[model samples]
Target: MPQLSVIVYGPNTQGHLTELLDSLDAHPLADAEVIVAAVGDWARETAGSHSPETIVVPLPDGTGDAAARAAGAARASGRWLHFVHAKDGLPAGAPRLIVERTAELDAMDTPGALAGPGAPDAPGAPVDVLLFDHVSTTWQTTAAPSGDGRLLAAVGRAGLPLDRSASLLRTAPLLGNRALRAAFWRAHEEEFTTDDEPYAACAALLRAGRVACLNQVAHEKRVLRPESLPPLAPEDRLALIDRYESLLALTEDRRAARTVLYDLMVRDLVRTFARENLPDPVAREFFHRASLAAVRWRPEGHQRPAGLEGVRHSLLEEGAYTRYRAFQAANRTRRAARKALRSRKRQVSVKVRDHQYRRALSRPVDPHLAVFTAYWDRGVACNPAAIAAKLAELAPHIRRVWVVSKENAALLPPGTDHVIPGTRRYWETLAGAKYLTNNVNFPGAVVKRPDTIHLQTHHGTPLKRMGLDQMDHPAAAQGLDFAALLARIDRWDYSVSANSHSTRMWERAYPARYTSLDHGYPRNDVFYTATAADVRAARARLGIAPGRTAVLYAPTHRDYEAGFTPRLDLAALADRLGENTVLLVRAHYFYGGAASPLTGLRRSGRIIDVSSYDPVEELCLAADALVTDYSSIMFDYANLDRPIVVYADDWETYRTTRGVYFDLMAEHPGKVAHSQEELTEIFLTGAWRDESAAKARAAFRRRFCEYDDGRAAERVVRRVFLGEPEEALPPVLPPEERTPAPTPEEATA
Candidate 1:
């Protein structure tokens, strides 16, 4: 038999199942079996595709999680059983750690070892349950270690019975953090028949002959937003009373266990009563049932907790539902008054603006209206612009308005309807529009309406760490308000991604409930749709000579730097490169209107500054080759099937401070240059366009340019704006089949 059997159970539509399985595969354990209790045909198929070696026990549709887990346990053929939910994942090396710990226990339980001075009564006196540490993650916050570490430390590596560690009951009530011996589980299997994991945990712990603690974090449990979770039925809420009663029976003889169990039961009920929005009848019935349980199961000489909780316990014993309601109402009134006072501290003009915005929000949403913004209202550009252009053709009935800054308003197309920020029309448009789309987040003050659908059309694939991932990299997260960032992310109804890599990274960085649309970036449609003549026109517009090779040098901004300091000496590099080549320098967008440091070289006719240029897509079309370092432009440029050279001089500092998702030096599209000399040598030696460079570029394109097929705009427009189903949306074309636009030289030839 295997050392351990891991059973994964959840619904068919669980989004993070693949991630969990991937984690297990990444950290393989010897002699460990994986069993997937797939609750539906779709889940079975997905599990099979992701992990064919996993033993799949297909449960019928609508089967409860409890039944599915029981089925998996019945099929397990190992010494120990560990359950994992599909949405949760194993930390790195967790499987090996667990298996090693179990092996140590097995050796201690061997026949010859039982006769030792401090040995147990029998050879089978091994630990019945092994509880470990876990981390809990919410949509807004980063993963934080859960459970009482001090309690686990007190138990130490040596085993202890549940009675000795009964205080652990107050720690997180989750089954994912514990492992049960298969034989011990079989003996008390009936106790877990119900769908209440916490009650099952309590029953198992109370009955276990021996329990141990492992202080390492083995599991990562995702805590869904309360509003995002489906509300439990009234019957399910009432069923908690039955589960607690059964748990009380198990703990009747042990005072320590009894006290912990009773306290836990009362705390669970109180939290449910205070937080959940139950019907009036169900609320009263729940309170009455909880009161009877609290009075009957109260341990002799058991003192209630201090302060507000103690008062709540007294009220529960008295069955004072009316008094509880009044108490809660008074507290809420005080909270509201304090909130009003805080609001009044703001500027009078700001308060007036907020009041007007709130009044506008009260109005009914306009179904036919949509608002669009990009790059913090610089103008309509990037994915938002592409989607808007497509909407004009396919969804003209849905009126579109662009949110632009005062300076950018003049850059918008002549007939484009637009509003400046901080204007009455802007607030009204944001409030009334049924569809709100942007590449960047809107103002934090914008309230998300129930009817409004916010689509986050991300501008580019992420290479550097984003969202909560930036928390550890203080340089990248300078003055970033994570709470406010998550609040904006919470407003998203859909997040668009360009490829599977991007989809996975986005999920890790932003753990929200938004649906992921793995459609190619709409902005990249021009890369595939532009013709030879269009390429030529773009080059001409950028003032590039017809036969000269144009190398576009675009570098990302450094968070550690206070200003937009140029990383490379543009004049020196431009002079080193032959007269046959010219450099098109584009600074990072953060320094858009700043004076170019290379203005002297611009007069020399070798360096062309395109920082203020509109529509970067045209710049991509105009360039023959791209040279970038740690910029997402390389990922987008790979779609053109052209040569790319990574000019990374401070790669070590950048990766350490910025926390890149992947090591660009190892997975670059083409040659990597650590210095200007190396960059110049690659061009002079013709290595930039050699066979090795082409092969590397092909591999990069296959990975990063999976969904750009000249029709991404149509796919997004159909799905979000037109409300077309996934089945009806346009399918993504393979990267190998795509043909990029011709270069200016090729077009002229």
Candidate 2:
């Protein structure tokens, strides 16, 4: 019979095993045999060094905690079993108290699985599991401590907080029928680590018999090492809240219920901010779902939480009234100040300082083909470098490539003429361009131009609310005045660049302008052909270790100046993957000079700030794995074929504030790592290199970039200049027809 079992999940630290053993050895009943189930060999070795008497069980590579625990249980022979992690320690007085409790329960009139003092000041003596007091001001540990673990909430009202006196009988009936436990665990193990839902379910099932807790503080839970898990995603919040609601439905203890609800609500608030700042469509979708869940809203179920009614009355209505009043006040003030401020003239178009525009216009326009580059917002996605390179590729023969941008000279590819004026001169700019191209939505409609070819190269294939399929947003009258803009868009602009997973969404969102072109930001072609040697060179230039796998984290900056203080757990992540993985932090161009508060991270030689990488090409090429919440570059990274992890830990508030164009959770092409631990697992395992992942990558290429043979610029020129349309573009090979690129030796043959 196993007296104690410690199940250590990876990538645990070097000293982690030592800490677990020392605590167990110090326990009052130190004579009890210790069983160690460790996933990684490093942890097992560490545990063995601390106590040779310890029985070391090596967990298989990919097995989860639940499965590992069951494996350990099967091999154990201790009279009582206690499960824990390498990082956790047993309570100071736990061993002696467990024996005493066992004796006391045995002598009692009715011997149950649990026998101990219960809730304080109740009609009866203290209940077995001591639940948290509703008014307790201390930060409550919602999840149970690993050492001397007991079944809480699931068995009864009181949440079992194991301290010195906490004990479980481990009797045959309490251990649950062997076959039943195995079957139940096998069926549900996959869902356990996903979120709190599986843990909640386990508690609900009452697999372990009546459990009890000691009111006295037993174990001092250690602070969580950083990088343990990826931060929570917006979707995670909704799932957690849903789990809490289900848990509440089962348990009768109001105090326990309130504690869970408080935690849920606080997490919901944090998630709201995360979504608002994510730049990608998928992240936006994550935000949309989380926002709906924050107020306990289920769009499909038509069920709303009772607490939402109060929110409707107090927050929503009051906010609307305040906004309206503020608007009225501002209007009144503007009217009175209008005459006095007459001398302040509106902003005019900026004058060019050089002869670049004149030289470009004089180059001449051929009627055979006209190229128009139009931009509505920040022109970063247009990949100015590639666009310039493409135009230069066609400069000798192709007639014209007119460039228009919302902000004049906003990242115009060099040698392209015609900078579109800002919002005030939008109509003027549209009229000047022979061809019109814009992404997502334009500021306002423009009169259709004659002989003008309209080609819409939409910015990206994001998965949040946007265009036609928006689920929730303020009335259209509010932002940018969509009605006027839609009416004026050039119907002839019949093309859009559909990136990965975008084929289905682009067609549905913009049926008219759908060309399904295989071209994304042409400048990314630079990275598509970038060599691993180039990555190494870039790292050397930056003075970072060449051996370390670079983790590039790029978070989009908010346009409204709404500060998003991202709490990245860098130290924790460094500790997990050892010292080999390096973190490169890059903020959006808009974040310009704002300093990141997540300091002291650079001291570890593990995390570095590379946001200064002007064009983002070097950073993209050097990164071994890309971790981002939302930024359009993910579309470009598809060309690299490296591991991609999305951190949309915040999804709700982002939708309500910024809005999404599509659903990221459903449409994204890679794994979603809502916590750091999951992210670290991916980094260490090269899990993205698996066969299934390769298949997904192939599918991704087929969907968005099938013709990427490093000849995108050449292909575009041939199609546009040589009068070739669909046939000019290379046909996407079927999966069976595809073959890996030959090595240099094979290519020479």
Candidate 3:
């Protein structure tokens, strides 16, 4: 049996695994064996081809990253364990280091049962470094001396050495050992997992005995794409606030929690309003209502740690209520400007006599259902498959489908003649849509129309908040006050999109009852298709030439309110593509309605602006490569097997400005580029040639999309059109048993 059971997860790094096997094959400890717990058949195949002697454990699909780690542990036979991802590489001499530590533990008359090589050294001796991190890789080293136990505990408490360096452990207890390594593991195995950074932090802190930090740069932490940084999502903002509160409570420190909470709350409020492309009328009203809400819900007693008093003090000194008043004043000015503009556009129209007799004589209707599908102004504007699926289900029985928008149009679904508009003629259009459904929440659609029943099929997955929207933001201080701005929002539709992360926000933000489902964009059904070959052939039939692989580079709009110009050097990008590869640049939907930055790309021989093309249609027949930053295209792209590259040059600023749904760097399985050169390299060479690319793809698929059997549209048709209950799919959860935290009510009670 192998001395160390190296359990690896993720398929993206299968190529890296091949390289790793070649590197490890030359190790001096030829006696040691390797065990790989792979996520898929691809991973297993990759590992098997390199080291057939290696024991391979196939992890269950849909078990999630954390569960895969636990499963690997359950199956390992080695006395010592080394758990990591395929993307992570061991230092040149990691095996020797682990073996040496195990040997040392074996040699001592009574060794410390849990001695790791890289932890801080004892006061007298030097600490052998085990883990070293670089710009893009991680290495496990073996060069730390023994350390005092108390020091280890202190460092753990302080949250020092945030990264988990490659750690070496003793298989058995040594100096005055309490229990064998197996026994120790059995007691703590439940605590181990691989759920991004925060979860990793929680697991590392909760378990482990006599932990050590090898300060050496054994690990090379790669620079992710600009869109991948500041991984916390809009929904995560609330959770992070709760986390800080928990940390403060653990330490019994009120000041610290208060400070962190205050800063996050203020920043969230600012970001919510700053990021929205609200009409002046809506923006003003939203600001007013938010200001009022802030004044009403004054945060009182959340604990705060001491050194962080400055945050709380600033809030007090600045006068939270006063800030809200200032917001209100600004919105008042905006409202005045909007009113003046309306006066100029207002046209006198004759009021028609009320035909009460004719209206009252109208035919009575059947049971009504309103569907609202809300979407961000990026990606494919509409999910046609979802719409078709819905239409297929409800066409004969359902009355009509009302497509709401900020601007009015007489657009209707194909094959349907029941067309309605929602711009300035919202009431007239809505009068016919008895059953209201929208992609996301547009309060304007349902707030006043009490007779219509509303059902929301949110356009995409939850990733961030929009407008002046957040539970933490005060109503009065709200930058985009929904109440005051109700008219503006109501102009579009009624509904909001949500996933597990932002589920609560849906209910909290809207006064009306909200519903959620597991289905993704109605349009994304194109990517999840049995007709992939057909789609490819369809593109061939179109002007898209044969033998040319397609690449879609889609980026979001800047709003210009964020004080940044929306620009991309398309010429530079086009110059980098291979002869057979074509680049499709999809600008943000809003940007598409304005001056486009894709002229340069369009001028190039292979690059084309897909701004006017429906994304689902384009994605179906047009892409072999995908490049995006902060847009939801990644989620849909995962349904296809094409490579994705994130060109997020403004990731850090965007996170600070609008926040994110998750950590892109840790979760996204693609090449991230911060510069044009990096973007070109990622698109041209790194995507396929780099061993780590495969692991990245695996991570992306697992997190953003899975179980795409090309029947997603069929599933939706069954559920929505047939009025089936949402039991067709299982709830998505990691395999690990998570301990649920207490709700506010439960804690108070």
* Model 2 spans > 4 angstroms off: 1-385, 397-430, 436-447, 471-480, 488-492, 499-501, 511-524, 540-542, 555-561, 588-601, 630-632, 648-670, 684-704, 730-749
Superposed by TM-score, candidate 2 places the C-alpha of residue 484 at a distance from the truth, in angstroms, of: 3.5
Answer with 2 or 3, whichever has the higher TM-score.
2
Error of 1 at 479 (Å): 0.8
How accurate locally is residue 28 in candidate 1, as Cα lDDT from 0 to 100?
53
The segments of candidate 1 whose C-alpha lies over 4 angstroms from its true place after superposition are 1-346
How do all models score by TM-score? 0.54, 0.45, 0.45
Q: How far is candidate 1 from the true structure (C-alpha RMSD, Å)?
A: 19.8
Q: Model 2's lDDT to the true fold?
A: 0.47
Error of 2 at 661 (Å): 8.7
lDDT of 2 by residue, 1-749 (tens): 32333333332443555765765554324435566776676766666676666677777566665555656655655444444545544433343334334334324413223322232222332223221101001122211222222232223324233221122211111111111122223333444333242442333233222334332222333346345645755345345445544543433333443344434443444334333444455444543443444444222322333653333323322334344335546656887798556534331122331133333344433344344443344443353335435655665543453445544465545655554444323434444445454444444434454555555555545545445444245432235444444453436444435354565666664445435556544555665466546666666776677456677888764333322233345555666678777788886665443433333236467778776565576777767667877676776666666666777655555555457665656555577665555666766777755665666655555655544445555555455434477675755444345333322222223
Instruction: State the C-alpha lDDT per candidate.
Output: 0.82, 0.47, 0.46
Summarize candidate 3's per-residue lDDT along 187-278 as a digit string, tens digits. Answer: 54554343543433333332333333322222212223445334543343334333333322322222332344344444444445556455
